[model samples]
Target: MGKGDKKSKRGKIINGTYGTRRKRKIKRKPSIEEKINVEKKK
Candidate 1:
């Protein structure tokens, strides 16, 4: 329930770590339309 608790989100954040309670953000790929636009610009 606190910083010492590894299973809690607050604890994960305080420890600067990721776990079941704190999932890392996923990087999104550019959409097909965006890629086409970039190619057109080039």
Candidate 2:
């Protein structure tokens, strides 16, 4: 196999794994109960 082919294969694997990790880091908006609880704490 050529060096270029090896690099492309590694790049594909890295890209696929990185995408799922990125999605997991995304924050969802708080629910109404969560918002109220936060205000109560303050």
Candidate 1 off by > 4 Å: 31-33
Please give the distance, in angstroms, between residue 5's alpha carbon in candidate 1 and its true position after superposition: 0.7
- Candidate 2 steric clashes: 0
Q: TM-score for each prediction?
A: 0.69, 0.38
User: How many pairs of residues collide in model 1?
Assistant: 0
Best by lDDT: 1
lDDT of 2 by residue, 1-42 (tens): 233332454454555543432344568899999999999999
For each candidate, the alpha-carbon lDDT, in order, equals 0.93, 0.57
Among these predictions, the greatest TM-score belongs to 1
Show model 2 residue runs off by greater than 4 Å.
1-26
